[model samples]
Target: MAQPYADTIACIRKSTAEMRDLQRGAMDLDAPGTEARLEQTVRELQARVDEQQAALEQLRSSSHVDIQQVAYASGNPRDKLKQLRAVTAAYTGLTTVAPFLPSKDSMLPALLAARALQQNIRGTKQAIASAEAQITANGALLKQEESNLHDANLIEKALRDRTVRLEAQIEDRSQKAPAQLAKELIAAKRAEKKRHDEETQRLGDALNDFVDNYLSAMLAAEELGGPVVGDMLNVENETLAAGFTKKGKAKATKKLVSGKTRQRRIDQIWGSKIAVEEEEEAPLTEAEAADAEMRELIGILFKTLTGPGGGRAYHQLERDSAASRFLIRAKIAQFHPKDAQKLRLIDFGRELDD
Candidate 1:
């Protein structure tokens, strides 16, 4: 029921629209404000570099202080060492100076100060270098984006012209008389319904097969004394675990309050059914939790199948090898919030040897 090129056409349309926006400089990347933002970033980085440079100059001035003269000026040994330590610590960024300390016998406060100043100067230069590199990278990216915007405009225009001509030709060739058109419409509707029915049946069969496999796996795990056997076996039956009865054909009946008539809502908009009232129940056990998760996943799959454009997507997945085995498994894992990482293709009973 789906056209083979539906996704491709949709992609082209989206790309063209984005290209049009880009050419108009309406997108964030190409907007007039983007340039202003870049300029602001450059100004901020430059200001930081200037601030660090000033700090560096102050540190250099402090490093040039005559520590040796200060230490010699102190007569007491203890006083000399204390002065040396004080002088070294007073230098900016030199408080973290380790492996170099003023001892009672020999104190080299000047060398400690010089090492700290060297580290600070190196760090300041590195920061400046990083900022400059980022600015250069940003300029290059902006140029590339601008060039791409021009190219995208050309491509978008060409594609629009081609698609318009092709669509016109298709429309001209597809015209039919009223009577014949009505007849063809009936046949097409029937065919599409048949396809839908077949896919639904297939999904139901897959669900049943999946339940069997799950039961089988649980049994096997039980035999092997696996860790989760108790949790898996806690549910009364596979039907209960799946939250539906086989005879009901996946329709779940809920008890309703007396004299009340109401429709029950399922997970999504398309899952409305007859319902009654709720009854108080105990909290879910580990087994019930797992069963609830499986029911939710099944509901999602059915919802996607019945949703708008879902038939086309499912048709693609059925026909395309790239979509069938790998993609279906991926979708299952993605939709399943719990045990996603633990899920395998075989668990769904869909993918075979190939």
Candidate 2:
């Protein structure tokens, strides 16, 4: 067999042996190791017996040949005389040529030499026939063995292909099956959501920073004689807006430019401060401080963006201008994702403007 196929078969056999061992272990927990050793000893004895049997067969085949005699012992006297005459003629012919032939012993008896040469020729013919039979048998056996090897190679290839398929299935089940894909998808989604949340948080922080700076700039501008908007809705103005029509005497007696009006407005403005002076002031929570800061920033931005006449500066920008695009992007980033998606669809295939 080829080396690779031999290795494959070895691997398969090893795997089969391991599986058999596991099965045997499961089937007989109390099986002794001595029993296995005994089985191995029996197998070895069987192999030795097979080898001896093959050797014995070869010996029997070799011993079956008969050694031919130089002369027949149970023939008629006339036939025996005839055979003697033939031997005499052969011996005479050999002696005549003996002077020209190479010989180890020149004085050896000619009759005995003729008889020995006759036996040797008969034995050689028998050996040649036996050798020819053995050659034919060997050729058949070689062809059979070649066929067996081809079959074994085919079986090995099939087993190797099956092993590859089984391994691929196992790999897919472990790493690419539906459950594995689902797990991967879930992990990817979680990662995407985490990234999205982080980006949103960063954008919010940036917006907050920008709002703080804008607020500080607006405050400085106001200090430099800008339009007064910080006190747009003071307590007195709120009171006047309420119209003072309630049946309560405090509301009914409220009049503009009166001492009571001034006192009520001052009281409303400083009520929390006065209460704090009377008792220990509690510190504001983080949420409360954030809300106050947000409210102040919103108030300033709202007043600045909307003029005293309540018309927004946003309404004055051209529809496709840079300022409009910035405003649109800011609104989309802030709170209009769904609307932005729709707008993006509408704007698809349209030429972009400045």
Candidate 3:
């Protein structure tokens, strides 16, 4: 059961695989590879098509046996045998033949030879019938496979065309990436130098300008602290409001970093002495220096308070810990005792009540 063009389609699949691999950026599909791969695929496909065509030609040649051979092999079984006997008798000259008559001794051998020839013909016909039946059973599947191959070929062609276009894109990106980066750098430098004039007749507008640049710089350098937004306020919208803190001073965060990014930013500004024998080459920004000092202070406090032979988890030192009486005074309370007790959960809180 041979499908037409099966091998040709298989070759196309190989080309498709090559195209897919090229897409994965394995080979750039540059000038030499493109032409060579395309030629190789074409050669293979042509070879397969040619080979299948030859096989089909052979099948056709064998199928077209002489009609006369099949014709005599047809008709009723007994009648055909009688006819065959008649023909065989004439062959041995047992019946009237021009100037010839066969003897009984010659007739027997001649008849045996004729019978053998008839049996051979019958076997050949039966073999041809079996072959036809097998062909009929498998022929549909072969044709179906060929049809699917055609669809796959079409998809493969699309993939090839798309690949050609994509190769151009890869080339374009390779050419433009550096130039584009330079362009972005120039734009960034220009933006850095461009400053908005903070001087305005309105004091509110002037202060807002400082807030804008301060936030911008804080974002650029995370060590630079900002106004404590959303603390003791109705919502984030009340960040600009006053009287939140008694001294109106915004509270700073505990210097705990939230993610690797902020930690890296801190490290970049304040180089790590922990990782090197000598100090890092770069000088620290003032904010960075302050943060480093605070970090050192916290480290010392932690080691003294809670490391081995320590008396505290430092739990009692906290403002609301149950062991508040263990400390002489609490320096970390959010408010004066009278007002602070008002914000307690219930029963004036166990810490304050105790």
Compose the digit string of candidate 3's lDDT tens values, residues 132-184. 57666678878888999999999999999999999987797677878796897
Worst 10 residues of 1 by lDDT: 261-270
Q: Residue 148's C-alpha lDDT in candidate 3? A: 100
Provide the lowest-lDDT 10-residue window in model 3.
235-244
What is the number of backbone collisions in each predicted candidate, taken in the order shown? 3, 0, 0
> lDDT by residue for model 1 over 1-354, one digit each (tens)?
123334544565566556546545532445465566556655665776798799878876889766456646488889778887776677745656564233432223433554665576566556656655766677789889989999999999999999999999668557866787778779999999999999989987886575454533343222222333334553333323233233323223354222111111121211222122267343332233333334444554455555674332222121111112233444543312343232222224434322
Q: Put down candidate 2 lDDT per residue, 295-322, tens digits, no spaces.
A: 4433444454345633222222111222
What's each prediction's TM-score?
A: 0.26, 0.21, 0.20
The candidate with the higher TM-score, 1 or 2, is 1
lDDT of 3 at 176: 82
- Candidate 2 is scored at a TM of 0.21
Every candidate's CA RMSD: 28.1, 32.6, 30.9
lDDT score for candidate 2 against the true structure: 0.47
Q: Which stretches of candidate 1 lie over 4 Å from their true place?
A: 1-136, 139-166, 173-175, 215-354
After best superposition, candidate 2 residue 50: deviation in angstroms? 62
**Clash pairs for candidate 3:** none
- By TM-score, the best candidate is 1
